[model samples]
Target: MGRVKHNMVKSLGKRTSSSVSPTDGSKKRSTLQMDLEVLECPICFETLTKPIFQCDDGHLACSSCCPKLSNKCPTCAFPIGHIRCRAMESVLGSISIPCPNAKFGCTDNVSYGLESTHVKECIFSRCSCPALDCDYTGSYRNVCKHYYSYISSRSTPLHHYAFLLYKASSTVRMNISDKIKIHVDYTNELLFVVQCFRESYSVCVTVSCIAPSSAKVGKFSYQLSYTVDGDTMTYESPDMKRILKVSFQTPLEKFMLIPHSSLRGDLLETKLTIKKVIQV
Candidate 1:
């Protein structure tokens, strides 16, 4: 089995010989194709990059995981994280690939082990679709287009408010969002997702922006107010969270909490005001 795998790798290397020649004929490069699992740390199963450490018996580990294991090698039960694995570091440094988000408008070529880190910070990284039936995934801009197109046919006409890039403040009437149901609204370029669910005897209303993690839009604060029994109830959040997906399993840290008594026959009429905060 080992010999067959080695022969396969050699075959791949030979296949790239003609293609890797530079136009100027100044140099030749060959692509090494192999299973990436071999480059992952056994402890964390993450790509191994710089500062890799090894045990006395040649068991390797990443730096972040070494301390958790108490500097002991799991394979050989020997002292670890003391000796540097320069060979592995050199191998990792030599291996580079285009960013996984390259097709999504990212034009970076990153080191092999550092691809995961780069993708996390890449603006072009794809965000998951919030809809349950949709399997769409794309960059932030593309995701917005897809979301708008998907909901456009079934969407009710909303009161459009022009949100200024520098300063924005708007108060709008929000229709009742059924219990444990999702409602999506758009104000200018931003999309707002609202969800309401019965929690014990109270209703929990959560509102968030469906955007990329690195969106440059300024911070937003909101105030939700509703009238019940001729009295007014209000909930305010200093900052609204941004999410890539609609998640019901995780409890939101900030949300509007309304008592069951505030409901008017399974209906809740609310008014929402959103303002963008300016940073000095």
Candidate 2:
């Protein structure tokens, strides 16, 4: 009976020791698990991707953290301006971030420092062409095509012989001929150049208002002729505001017209009116 009682006591002791060992091991494992799971930015409360340190006060934050504490800690009111830790930064930089737009069909996980650059070049990014009366917006390639289509639809058709005129100053008769070349002056207030007739006869034109605050008023005259391979060809003017004068020398047609320019308080305005004279 005594031997049985002693063995029972020893068995109970062994059981207790065995139970205590597992409990201690479980506690240690639980602590390690908590430490592994606690990796997150304190400021953002998200996974610690691109982590940055606030100070020695144990404020771990993300790199994109905003200045919310006026350069001081909100919790302890500690100055954080001079506080920096490169080791913490490197640790944060090693973290991975799930795409913010992941729900929008992005499945990329990138470093926090590379998030902005990735978003900039993302194929899913949409942009719209900035044009009046255009409603097109899409991917970069689509936007390019949309812009081209809009521009092509609104572009003015070029004519074989065309003349554009603007007013410069009063009593100054400036003529832009299809047979003359025009040059622009950058230093002058109004500088432009016109070229015609294969750059044979070019003209440099400039006009400045006599008064800085007031607009300069003037008129313009234009003459246009069409030719092909040194042979005269028939041509026509498409505007009617000017008196169209047409003359024919064999197969060649020459047209001349006078136009006007107006100014209102430093604004110069000119309009071109085209009229048809000949087709062949």
Q: Please give, for residues 1-280, the per-residue lDDT of candidate 2 as tens digits.
A: 4344334333433210111236554533211112312344555454444435565585655455536645666567666545565776664454555554476567888674365556544544444443434556554445545545555576562211122223322122223432222122212322112222211232222211111111121222332333223543222333221111111111122332212221122221222222223322
Error of 2 at 267 (Å): 9.0
Best by TM-score: 1
Q: Which candidate has the highest lDDT of all?
A: 1
- Which residue segments of model 1 deviate by more than 4 Å? 1-38, 48-58, 62-71, 79-97, 109-121, 152-188, 200-202, 215-219, 225-239, 258-265
Report the lDDT of model 1 for residue 217. 49
Query: Candidate 2: which stretches are off by over 4 Å?
Result: 1-51, 61-71, 85-91, 97-109, 122-124, 132-135, 151-280
lDDT of 2: 0.36
Q: For model 2, where is the 10-residue window of minimal lDDT?
A: 242-251
Model 1 Cα lDDT, one tens digit per residue, 1-280: 4344444434434211112565776767766555555567877766676799999999999999899999999998899999999998877776666787877777998877576567655777776666666789876556666766776655563332222222233343333443333333434345666667777787777767666545364567777777776898788888777666667753657877878877766666666666666666
